[model samples]
Target chain A: MTTEVLTTTGAPLLQVRDLQVTFTTPRGRVRAVDSLAFTVEAGRTLGIVGESGSGKSVTSLAVMGLHRDAEVGGSIALAGQELTALSEKELSRLRGRKMAMIFQDPLSSLHPYYTVGEQIAEHYRVHFRSGRAAARRRAVDMLGEVGIPEPARRAGEYPHQFSGGMRQRAMIAMALACEPELLIADEPTTALDVTVQAQILELIARLQQERGLGVVMITHDLGVVARVAHEVLVMYGGRAAEQAPVDALFADPAHPYTRGLLDSLPRLDDSDDEPLRAIPGSPPSLREPAPGCAFAPRCAQAAAGTAQDRARCADVRPALEPYRSPDRLVACHFAGVPADAAGRTPANVPVPGPATVRPQGTDPDQEVSR
Target chain B: MTTLKPAAGPAPAPADGSAPPLVSVRDLTMTFPGKRSATGRRGAPVRAVDGISFDLAAGETLGLVGESGCGKSTTGRMLVRLLEPTSGSITFDGRDVTHLSQGALRPLRRHLQMVFQDPHSSLNPRQTVARIISDPLLVQGWAAGDARRRAAELMDLVGLIPEHIDRYPHEFSGGQAQRIGIARSLATSPRLVVADEPVSALDVSVQAQIVNLMERLRRELGLAYVFIAHDLSVVKRVSDRVAVMYLGRIVEIGDKKSLYEDPQHPYTRALLSAVPLPDPAAERRRERITLLGDPPSPAAPPPGCSFHPRCPKAQPLCKTERPALTVAAAGPATREVACHFPGD
Candidate 1:
């Protein structure tokens, strides 16, 4: 694909450094995003995964320059332009022309009254400065490109007229209408069904390859990361816990939070009898930043912190450093699978099928075992 | 996924071994009136759920799964008489209960209940846990003091602390709120409870807690559930027999093991393939069947099978004639599928 070649030849499509986002709620200033940084290369998909309120969405919003009434500190460079240095008017011009985003709920993203084609055409004309006829034609072409059937007729229908999956397809078509270089998808398929969700993920991956677009796919689902992402950044308590190639991260996740996240999801192959390793506690709040490792409270394998290792985690934050592999970087004082455990698949393999006999109301099996 | 050995002994046949099913649905259809055109005339009606049939044996849990606007939710609502059906019959213990007037259905209402998806929203924001659980008992005309005691028992049965009774819905977590919702549904000791995506709205950690709690309650209370959800993994875990839904029809129905290990319908295969496997090695190698199109609009469904537009193995027969649910040649006695071209 042209995107893969472009990523290999040129610079990363977008580069972020030391990004920080803070919000002032009624209670106090909340450090929602703390020193977060990552890069999205052309044709490459960078997955940002974390639970709710873990700053995954906030970081994405910061990249899009969409957050309001919040203080942002750090550098966000698109291609060769520094977005943090751009004025609001300059950023506005860059939004649809250079970058676009797709949200979780397409129902709210698209204007209901306007036909899908009209909205896409409006974006086309506004950003591309094409004539009405040309823009309308482009809208239909884009819809067809996104795999929507009967695009000519379907494009004229309002958002409410389309089904959930169709509306999402339309939203994808609109996001690609402008052919933006960077596509920030925030839980784009969370509201979709498994089959439809897979289609959407494939659609995004296919489009990224065909259009040579860099994608920042945000989600709370690791299954998606395993299949679609070229690179992944596991975030916890507003910080990047681990970042590595998809294969590397899955093979040996260096951070405790990443391991915990992977263990929490129920596997399809697990036999109907094995118990799921559900992460016991929820993600920690960032209101009062932890003195030590943010995950220490929930980390089952928290290493013994003497005066040295524990001091940096509490007061001086650790830098994102290369862990065992050169490509994989983790921001933790203690990172890496113990030397002996290296090259071995964790016994925690989720056996396929139904999980083990769970106490009622605890497993999805409750509905079947009546 | 875990393997399920058949429950001990011959799976108990019907309550009292009666020939009549505990719940019977015949030719059930529902249509929602569409909006009026610009001329103030009604537009075409939307056939949300076309004619369908099924039976629920006493103590059995039937699972319904499908995408949005596929009428899965509508079907659940109709079973409990929450929404009026445009056509068909719903018989409870051989008694025709469909079309009963609100005043007349009150007595039957005590036997059937529903648990909604979002515990936070399903519960009253202003009412305390005690009041919420007592509402159903009070509706049944139970004495105030007796209702309070029953509510407390139900709360404890659901694993909530006694101190939680005085607290409002806002005070509890998502899982706790769901426990309260379950407690309220059990207030009247209903025979069947239609829980619609009960755990889909919560976190993964919390989902297990709620599912386990529901299972224990069922064992202890002898309550049955019509579990509705889009998550097949969760459904397969809970249901004894599973019903695979597409558009507005049941594509496949079978015992839990048969449905999970050897799904009969192409749609079921696709749905199963789409489920994410937690194990990286297995996930990388599993065969995936990608479906083609979105679910068709119910208002004007396709000429024949609603799933034809997206079915990978769709044939001419699928487009020309609707399929009927029939016992599969290689399936268990309880297994049935409504597809001309079923299987991967």
Candidate 2:
């Protein structure tokens, strides 16, 4: 199933397993991400979709070795090299060269005083130990590569001088300056307008194609997921609700939370005659230890299920396991059960739209063969 | 414009476009004085809402959509009289309320209310949900007991547990806090509600819940709405007619069906195309009209069309002469587009 594909001489670009991130807050210990697992192969984009406080950003920060105060556990490997075992010094060496992340806000992510060009040049010099002249040239080249017109003039301008879209493009240029093998973008286009968002998404798609980079796009927008992701990992209540190929995830979501999310979206192409089947309750709080399933309280299927089914959901924490097919994993008690016996909402989420409207971005062969 | 407080009129004749509109706005404009320089020289005044006119039939939702700083929010505020317009007329229920003083505007406020974006920030964190919802009713001379009871009912109306009326805003989730905001907006049973990006801050699942609730309330209460948001899909779901604004002017206005399927204005086409569809195959098949650059600042908007700088179909005449919002020359007669080459 896995080739260590795309660019030659790679041992699985990025692999994460049993990843757990916890924080010591004033209130108490908060488990931001719990028992989440996913992999990103070279030339393929892995989308991490979740709501606010679902630990999407936490997972990205952990991958980039940026979580200093938080307690991070479990294995995070890049090209078969263990990252959790690495020290601060070693991790710093790997950060910009091995992996880089772009944040939602470009203005704050960048320094206000420094020229955009200088920041990119400095980042390049830190990672590659290049001199001023060479790093400067590299920064301009990256700026031009990212489709920034008049790169020479724009590079000298400060972040505040650039518009929102231009600032984001500059941020992308800075992220790709060293040509990192892996890129983790956390809501990269959330702050920009829809027009600008499309341009940035297109730019990212083109750059990924040209460089064959392993990309992890974290966002709350399902439309972006449908457009860019080869595979999707849906996070809920600090846990992986479901993980599957983009088409399967959208077409036939196995987890109740996943189904609720898909049904909840008011699509542009679809008619809005029927009331959206919104998930009934708010997101779960991570303060307490969840002995049973994290989503049992809000899962509509469990609510409509039998006493035995409800008890199983509330008493046992369902493990992330293969459902129907090994490639599609679902964390739910009633995943593979018959539709009529179990509630119909969970397993039968696909509205006969999968085959006819399958997104074209989930071609694994192209990613592998390129 | 100081007419006696007339009786709260009967629920406006069901829209049908035949009856007089519940709200009629013409040539509305707001000019916010620019910030002063270090030398104390004031900059050019920002014309936030340029000359824009529209009619909102009773019980109909007119969605206002545009990018940030495009004046959709400004237009919404003007409708509610939160920000007084520098020039133009605003007639509500056949009465001119454009320049009504705060004292004179108080009675009319019961018929018009606004739901702001960022529910948490808009709501007072210190106040309990009961007090928050009942404040409007109390101001309108309802007895204390009656106002509080109505507050509880409003909470239940918006799907919140009435028993938890004493809970503070922080105790609730993002979705629940927004429900309180909605409850507060509907407190006085306003006939027209101007919601400014009500669901943008909410998660997708919760956004759906709120949208459905709002739709139901509008239907059951015979309410009209001016839904202002940046999200096209949500607006499409809730609106009967939609107006697209760019740089302080509405570039396009039409029925939701006509606007979505066949956008006439170049900027509208680009904006609609920019909204990524959830369907992947459709995304692959459709062509996107990517605007060349960002929208020009309203402080110094382009001379002719505000969109001329980035417009793909802009001509020499477009650069020199401003295009007025007029009926499209071709295609759907159901729309008014402000472009030199609409439906080209």
Best-performing candidate as measured by TM-score: 2
My TM-score estimates for the predictions, one after another, are 0.85, 0.92
DockQ, prediction 2: 0.42
A292-352 per-residue lDDT for model 2 (tens digits) = 7877766766655665666677789999999878889998988845434444545533332
Give residue B84's lDDT in candidate 2 (0 to 100): 97
Where does the lowest 10-residue lDDT sum fall in candidate 1 chain B?
B1-10
- Candidate 1 C-alpha lDDT tens digits along B27-102: 8899999878899999778988887788887667788987787788999999999998899999986798889899
Residue A316, model 1: Cα distance from true site in angstroms? 10
| Regions of candidate 2 where Cα sits further than 4 Å from its true position | A1-10, A336-370, B1-17
Which prediction has the highest lDDT against the true structure? 2
Distance (Å) between predicted and true CA of B331, model 2? 2.6
lDDT of each: 0.78, 0.85
